[model samples]
Target: MITIILICIGVLFNIFGCVGLIRLPDVYNRLQAATKCVTLGCCSILLGVVFHYGLSDAGFKALFAIPILFFSATVAAHALIRGAYHFGTKLGEKSVKDDYKEVVK
Candidate 1:
């Protein structure tokens, strides 16, 4: 029952992540969506896998993957966003506040 619920939640978040990737206007926002939502969704699914298959090799792999996913997702997102900034990807028209502008000044 818990597994089913977790799977559903994961799927929902995955869908939202994909939608955000497609719908967001700028690279930074898309990266934010992908990193936050997809990582969270994938993590939940991996945890469910661990719970469903405890102590076995599959469980161990899932357990290992959780931290790897966390680390890699964060680092990759950071790198991508930084690269986008370096390349001068413009912010969407609706964006408020130029935080980076202030920092760079």
Candidate 2:
């Protein structure tokens, strides 16, 4: 029951992330949406797996993967966004703030 709920929530989050990717105006915004939402969604699904399998091997794997996915996804997104910015990718028109603009040379 709980597992199903968690999985359903995770699936919804994943769907939101996909939608964000399609609808966002620029690469930076799209990447932010994809990274945060999808990472959280996957982590939730993995938590569901842990609840379902308890102390089994599959559950342990899922447990370990949660942190790896979270950290790796965030780090990778930051790196990609930084690279894109350095390569001269511009932000969306509606974007109001750019902390990086002042910091990065």
TM-score of each: 0.88, 0.92
CA shift of 11, model 2, Å: 0.5
Count of backbone collisions in candidate 1: 0
Which candidate leads the pack in lDDT? 2
Q: Against the unseen true structure, what C-alpha lDDT does each candidate score?
A: 0.89, 0.93
Model 1, stretches more than 4 Å misplaced? 102-105
TM-score, cand. 1: 0.88
lDDT of 1 by residue, 1-105 (tens): 787788788888999999999999988789989999999999889888888998899999998999999999999999998878778888888899777876543
What is the alpha-carbon lDDT for the whole of candidate 2? 0.93
Candidate 2 per-residue lDDT, tens place, 8-83, comes to 9999999999999999999999998999899999999999999999999999999999889978998999899989
